[model samples]
Target chain A: MKLKDIIAALDAEVVSAEDLEKEISGGYCGDFLSFVMAQAPAGCAWFTVMSNHNVAAVAALTEVGVTILCEGVEPDEQLKAKAVGRGLDLIVTAKPVFEAVKALDL
Target chain B: MSSLHLEFDVAGNNFVSAGSASDEVKKTLKMLGVDPVAVRKVAIAMYEGEINMVIHAGGGKASVDIDTDKVKIVLADEGPGIPDISLAMKDGYSTAPDAIRDLGFGAGMGLPNMKKYTDEMHIDSTVGVGTTVTMVVNLR
Candidate 1:
């Protein structure tokens, strides 16, 4: 799915507008950064409640299609700046974790 | 064979920049045209060490060397050293506080996962002094 499509599906806010057109293969839901680092696949959308600079760092390493912050989670200005530096796309959502997992797959 | 060497200073308790060094190393490996599979392995192993340095040790030094056939990482820290390397190596062992866990780490997977992804692993630690870990991931 395209990132924009997923954003619309989840009613998410675009935290990183540069990535609206990117392609995503699927989705992964995990709160643990280490677990996601070890297990997240390339080109997948990572759904998390984490709001930190390290999240962007992890997204860059995994090459995830996008990072969706669910449960109204928002990345602070610092992480937003870091995401810009790292070229990581982030989206904010009010949906619960289950909604994203049920609506997306890899 | 030719090689590249890089070093980073990991600040103890600085979670915001925990994996910056590993991220840089990943980019370097990619630019050098290392195999994608090998690069990912090195990234994971090195990133784990970076987190360990921040959470466990006060902060330390990380050195990475990528030669023709392998990537080697050395992490040294002056925090309270591991009293028992054997026990810490256990899959489900962890000493990180609840605060660290709240940030999505402290899962007891740091050293074990690092060892899992590397071709070679070594640890030297003193309870009163500190700890140093060396890991190598081969390209062949």
Candidate 2:
């Protein structure tokens, strides 16, 4: 599914500039940065409450197309900037992580 | 030279920039045309080491070398050294406080994860001194 479609379906707010048309094959949810990096599938929508800068790095290394910060978590500006720097997109939502993951319908 | 060297000084107690070195390593590998899987292994190994340095060792230095068939990573820290390498390497062993866990790390997975992704891993530590981890990822 296209990331833009997932964003719209989840009502997530984009925090960084990037192409939303990118396709993501699956989803993985984990707050542990190392686990996410080592195990997450590429092009997956990463759902997590962890909005730290390292999240962006994990997304990049795992080649996840976008990060969905859940549970009303807002991306810190530094995190947004870093995500942008790495060619990754960040979005936030008031929805719980499970709810957001369901929205992707992957 | 069979290896190309890169260095980064990791700042301890700085959660904000924990993965900087690893990200740089990933970018470097991509630029140098390394295999995609090898790049992933090197990035994950170095990143876990960097986070350990920041969360437990109060910061450290990371040195990496890229070669035709292997990528080598060495991380050194001056924090209170590991008392037991065997215990530390256990998949679920970690000494990090709750605060570190709250950040989504320190789940006793760092060292094991590092070893999991690399082709070869070694650890050297001195009590009341520091620790050094050397890892290699082979491209072939």
Candidate 3:
């Protein structure tokens, strides 16, 4: 699935769009940055309620396809700036983590 | 001898910029044509050490030496040193306050993750003094 399709399916709003055309191999949901760093599959969309700046770092370090902030969570200002500055694809959705993952049906 | 050497001052308690050094190192490794898997390993290990410095030590110094075969990361800090290295190595052990945990860290995975991703790990810490962690990830 392409990032744009997943965004449309979840009705997610773009927070910092780096690559909407990137392919999404799958998804990994977690809030713990270290856990995500260790376990998140490369090129998979990361679903989490974590809104802090470290989220961007973890997403970038893990090479995730895109970071999807679920449960209506919004990225903090630092995170927003970092995402844009670092070219990290970040999005937000009203659905919770599980539902957002389900909606993608990946 | 290393082909490249880089250093950074990791700001203490600065969660906003905590992983900047690691990010830079990852970029350097990528640019040097290091294997993606090895780059990811160095990135994860170094980032974990950098985060530990920010959360525990009042910031610290991180230096990286990239060679043809391996990347070595050294994180040194002057903070309340680890009382027990063995215990600190435990996967679920952490002394980080709940506030840090709320920010999505301090789950006690930092050291373990560092050890997990790297080919070599060392800890030199003393109570009431400081701590330094060294890790090396070999390029494949």
Candidate 4:
């Protein structure tokens, strides 16, 4: 599925890279970085409220297809730029973390 | 066999920088044509160890040696060491403070998960001096 679908499905806002909605995949959710590193499959949509540059780094390392920031938390401009430069689809959702994950049908 | 060695200094209490070492190791392994599964295993195992070093041990050093037969990781920290290795190895056993938990870590799975992902694991630690973890993931 395209990233646009994920945004539409979850009623999320496109926080960055409004032009790159073509990149999307299955959803994976976890707050624990270690657990996500271990279990989050490569090339999948990742949903978390982790609001740090490290989240973008993890997405780069894990090759996550996209990142959905839940709970309406907005990352700083640096992180947003990093996400865009890394070609990651970044979105923001006002819904709770679990609800965002559920909307993805993961 | 000539080994590829990589070293990283993990910063104390820096959750944002925790995975930097693992990320570099993963990239190096991938460039060297290590098996993808083995790379992932080593990445996860070493990443967890790095996080533990930051959270519990006040940061430390991580050294990884990659050879034809195995990838070896050594993480050494100078914080308060584990009093009971076996107890600490159990799942859901954590001594990390609640503050670390708010960052989505300190779940007590660091040691257990490290052991789970590596083929061989050894931990040497003193209560006050420091802790050293050595793990080997065989490359078949």
Is 1 or 2 the stronger prediction by DockQ? 2
Candidates sorted by lDDT, descending order? 3, 1, 2, 4
RMSD to native for every prediction?
1.7, 1.7, 1.3, 2.8
Docking outcome class, model 2 = medium
Which scores greater on lDDT, model 2 or model 4? 2
Query: Top DockQ: which candidate number?
Result: 3
Candidate 3 clashing pairs? B12-B59
The CA lDDT at B90 in model 3 is 97
* CAPRI tier for the interface of model 4: acceptable
- How many clashing residue pairs are found in candidate 1? 2
Most lDDT-accurate candidate: 3
| Clash totals, every prediction | 2, 2, 1, 0
The list of candidate 4 runs beyond 4 A from truth reads A15-26, A60-63, A76-82, A85-88
Name the 10 consecutive residues with the lowest summed lDDT in model 2 chain A: A52-61
Model 1, position B79: C-alpha lDDT score: 90
Candidate 3 chain A weakest ten by summed lDDT = A18-27
Give the C-alpha miss distance for residue A3 in model 4, angstroms: 2.9
Name the lDDT value of residue B29 in candidate 1.
90
Native-contact recovery for every candidate? 0.56, 0.67, 0.81, 0.33
Per-residue lDDT for A57 in model 1? 72
Residues A2-66 of candidate 3 have per-residue lDDT tens digits of: 88899899999998886678789977888888888878889998999999888988988988989
DockQ of each candidate's interface versus the true one? Answer: 0.60, 0.64, 0.83, 0.43
lDDT per residue for candidate 1 within B1-140, as digits (tens), equals 58889999999898887888998899899999999888888888888998898998889999999999899999999999999999998876899999888878887878888998899999999998999999999997
Instruction: List, residue by residue over B1-140, the lDDT tens digit for candidate 3.
Output: 44898999999988878888998998888887889999988888898998898988899999999999889899999999999999999988999999999999988898999999999999999988899998998877
**What's the lDDT for residue B128 in model 2?**
90
- TM-scores of chain A across the candidates, in order, are 0.91, 0.92, 0.96, 0.84
